[model samples]
Target: MLVPSCENDGGDSKIDIQYGAVINIQKSSSSDTYINLVALQNGGDINLGFTIDKAVGDITSMDVVGLYIKSDGTTIFKGKFSTGIKTFPYTLNINKQKIYDAFTQLNSSDDFETGDQLTISAELTLKDGTVLKLINDDGSNNFSSNIASSSTYKVFQAYNVSCPSELGGTYEFTTTNVKAPTGESAPGPLTGTVTFEDQGGGIYNISDASFGGWTGLYGSGNIARNVQLKDICNKISYFGVDQYDEVFTFSNLVVNGNKISFHWENDYGEYGDTTLKRTDGSNWPALTL
Candidate 1:
């Protein structure tokens, strides 16, 4: 009789799962999430919006905070952006005046330099006196891997300080002393016209990276057309692969008024020194590196 009483019940066993709250980024004014230095200097605002998901929790209120992270990795607590916010969705209009005030409160003498970042996060208070937040006191994330990996569960947003790029136009490209793979002179000085088409956010689509040297060495059909240039806060660099899947390296970058000159080499042992001058009679903004 005791052994017969060990029969299973008809009801199914279940495990209940509860999820914590999350901050979902709804929209951003800048697609690249950058705070334009030129616009900030001209009295513009940093605009973004987010929504709080309750996620099976009883949330009473939330406090939004900001942290200013310098380029050297120093983190400064800029203090709360909003306290006791009971709203589900909120829009942030961060102006230069508010940023300046925060810096002043911290007694920091540093300006809002390029490459610095401003991160926004929040602290949520539940009905049972429980506080939940993504960031810790030491300016580090304290959340689960599942929440961190969720694209829709964005707990924080970082906006970088960037300079406005205006380096898109037609340029007269000149290449000299191009060398082949065997270290032999493949071509003499070659001159041509190239276009710097703006692709936004300091990126430009160059008409050609070889500056007619590839056409001189190979045929016109083998010219590098997929080459791209990046001007990050005046630092110039090359990226993107050529048709042969070879990467390009750049050096000796010098910017003089309306002219930009640099030395470039590819993985195939081909190299050249090139100079580019704007044909619109407009001087390029001061650049370095």
Candidate 2:
């Protein structure tokens, strides 16, 4: 059990890392076609994002511009290769709502596969009339594949957010070569911005101050909520304990996050695994066209 912030006389426990508001645009199923927005921590970082699990990169190099994603409640373009944090000249934060909505409107007509490469190479003409070039170690190609993306969707980060500034705002999105997978290239490139509203509170504070505590966490911990995802669920277990290289079994399980929450058996016990409850109400929202 975690010590309550109120009971911490030693002042060792702080509170949940506070962060500015940030939005998350995510879908329900890997193949489901819908998305919804959620807020980042209250004075914390935006650590959630979307990933394109499988991509055919030979035809889709970094310079292939005209690709964007609508996850995390914002519209933004991620380069073919990135740190998932930096996309060259800009930082990855949820754009303001006004901009986000506009771009999403334009992209509403866009058709995409569930797991297509999100970025590609494009040409930028400089004031001097020189087209921006893609770089290569051998200087043979203008683009290269980035190491940051994986076959599975991973988190994109909106670093160090705060209260008022990160709230409702606009965002921008661009796309190019947005063609069906069976095609040679995408439907040209679409570059534009979108505007959106901060639909919900941008942050959630788990603090003892709200309840008079002195620790990093303040609320009652739900034993069932110990698991938040599949991996987290796999980590917990209870029964005739056995220490494998890395394994655990949990009892009375609960999962939390986004909208959906549930659990089952820990791969042990009799008719066992885990189960879910809708006590908190509402499952994660959907976003897809």
Candidate 3:
């Protein structure tokens, strides 16, 4: 818990200062097919943000600290703000190379694996050299508190993973043309079969996609697809090459059990929805295309 702002108790007035940090995970947008993760070995960059709420004194600089610990209480990585933060709601983009160095320093570990947890903490340095640390009831600044909202995050190696189990096998699909340009023929009820091949780690590849008579923007061919399951919002994403050999991506799909549906629009203002159902009980071998 953070100590509430208090001033003037014994006739001596002192400024109350509060600060904290938040780990921001990038959210997927309509244009984003997958969320990218900074590989531990290859090294990547991620943004770290901070919040400074109450401060009576002039805050000169704030130092943010982070540590990546393993299950054995070993500090695999330790990183800090190379310089003082000069502004509020400050965000720092940290490179994974620095993290790799920290890991090498600990046990000479060359690489990282999944399930690595990272704990971050922060402190404030006032202009007059007054240092205020994140305070907790236990006198530890490791965990998140009202003063500093620190947090631990689990590391994932891959990004843009699709649902492997439920998506595999063949599915019957029905597509209806919802909107089309003026003088364009509105598509009628279309039916087809789409075979999904599991590519491991929640990835699937779709081939032999036939949408009746309605030709897709990509010409009704094979498409690479993935999915991102958020807290409540889920999307079935598609990536393919068009007739012009240009790459395209479309998402905002809803999947319920054996049924999957999505709506898409191109730059030409053509749009429609395709609903899919798995009537055939077929589960292909994992990672076999």
The numbered model that scores best in TM-score is: 1
Write one digit per residue (lDDT tens) for candidate 3, span 1-289: 2334658879887877554332222222322222123232334333333233323345677666555654354534555644477766454343345445444443322444333444444566766675755432232453333323223321111233122134556678787764445535446566777666754333456553323323533445433233221210123334343333333234556656666666655454556677777776543222121
Tell me the TM-score of model 1: 0.52
Candidate 3: pairs in clash: 162-202
TM-score for each prediction?
0.52, 0.19, 0.34
Q: What is the lDDT of every predicted structure here?
A: 0.70, 0.25, 0.44
Backbone clashes counted, model 1:
0
Q: lDDT by residue for model 1 over 49-100, one digit each (tens)?
A: 4444444356788888778887677656567777898877776666566666
Looking at candidate 3, the ten consecutive residues that score lowest on lDDT are 154-163
Q: Candidate 1's C-alpha lDDT?
A: 0.70
Residue 201 of model 3 has an lDDT of 32
RMSD of 2: 23.2
Q: Which stretches of candidate 2 lie over 4 Å from their true place?
A: 1-110, 113-117, 120-272, 283-289
